[model samples]
Target: MSKGQITKARILHQAAELFNQQGYAGSSMSDVMDVTGLKKGGIYNHFKTKDELSLAAFDYAIATLAQHHRAVLRQHHHAADRLLGIMAVFSSFIDHPPVAGGCPLMNTAIEADDAHPALKARAQQAMTNLRKLLCHIVDTGIAKGELQPAVDSDVFATILISTIEGAIMISKLYDDPVHLERAIAHLTDYIDEYLRI
Candidate 1:
């Protein structure tokens, strides 16, 4: 990569963690400067406004997460195993997170709602993509006779996403990992006993 490209990536990486942790409203230009060790002009040269940086940072974070999910999902052949793989990825966050502050989708969704329209839209799109992926997996499973044909893919996708996101939020709020652990257990059971054919 070129010098400018490297610097911009560095800025995005640092800014993503800061924004995820402190949030868009809480993080300041100085904080970005501190994190990147770049002067005002250097930062402004790459991003015209804080909003631009926030948007880019969010994309970077989400893209990183999607890459991780793809890696985990690739390991499992069956749809049920793939679904459990998703749960395992989220459960792993209790100990080691892909990003600094936890799930970017959950964090951005909570903070961006009614505050940052662009960020909120980005978060919404991310969820939509996730749900679509889950639906496809479940649908494929049913077609392959691996999952019950009567199952509603959309409902299952929504429930899985909601359960995991809720668990992440509760675990973070209560400063306890057990909440996520229980949620993961329930999700595992749901996949194996209920969804599997």
Candidate 2:
């Protein structure tokens, strides 16, 4: 990569970590500059405004998370195991998070609401993608007779996504991982019920 590209990537990485640790409102360009050790002009060279950096950081975090998902899926072939592997990915996140800022979607969603329409839409799309991943696995299971065909893939996907997001929120607020574990257990059981049918 070019030197300029490397620096911009560094800036984005630092900014994403900060934004994940703190909400968008809590993060500042100066904070990013501080961690990045880049001058105002240097940071602005890649991103015109802190808002631009924030958007870039949000996208960076989501992309990183998606990469992890791909790795987990490749490691586990069974749909339920893949789903559980996803759970493991999130569960391990509580203990050893890739980015220090926390879940970008949860952080951004809680902060943005309707104010940042563009960011809110992006975050919603991330959530939708997550659901689709889960739904795809479950649908595959049904097709293979490993899961019951009577199950509603979309509803299941919705519940799994909601539970995961909600659990992350609770985990953050309570400073405990049990909320996340509960969500995973329920998700596993939800799948188990299908397997038994």
Candidate 3:
């Protein structure tokens, strides 16, 4: 990477953390400057506006999450195992998160819903991709005879994603990890009792 590329990445990295932790509205240009140790001109040189920086930061955050999930998914060969691995990734967030604040998808979706169109759209696409990934895993499991043939991949994917995301939300809201733990336990039961062939 060139010097400019490295600098831009550093800015994005710091900006992603700040935005995820403090939120778009709550975080300011000074916060970015403070994190990146860059002056206003230096920051604006890379990003024309805060909105531009926010969109890029969100993409960076989502990409970070995708990378982590991909790594976790690679560890299991069985379809059911892969699904459980994915669940484990989310469950791990209860104690250790890839990023500081928690799930960027949930955070951005909630904060950007009515305010920022571009950020909201990015979050929506990230979620759509997540759903597709889960569906693909379910379909692969069915093909391998690891999952019930009658199962609807999309429906299963939706249920799993919704359950985990809701669990994360409630856990964060109450500052309790047990909610996430119980949710993952129930998900595991559902998979073993209902989805497994």
Pick the lDDT winner.
Answer: 1
Scanning candidate 2 in windows of ten residues, the lowest lDDT window is 188-197
Q: What is the TM-score of each candidate against the true structure?
A: 0.98, 0.93, 0.96
Residues 8-85 of candidate 3 have per-residue lDDT tens digits of: 999999999899889999999999999999999999999999999999999999899888889978788888888999
In order, how many clashes per candidate?
Answer: 0, 2, 0
- Model 2, 121: alpha-carbon shift in Å? 1.2
Error of 3 at 55 (Å): 0.7
Better of 1 and 3 by TM-score: 1
lDDT of candidate 2 over 1-197, digit per residue (tens): 99999999998888888888877788777888799998899999999888888889999999988888999999988777887788777876687776775677778887889988878888988888888888899899888777777888788777777788799889988999899989888878876665534
Of the candidates numbered 1 and 2, which has the greater lDDT value? 1
Off by over 4 Å in 3: none
What RMSD, rounded to one decimal, does every model reach?
0.8, 1.5, 1.1
Clashing pairs in 1: none
Best candidate per TM-score, number? 1
True-structure Cα RMSD, model 3: 1.1
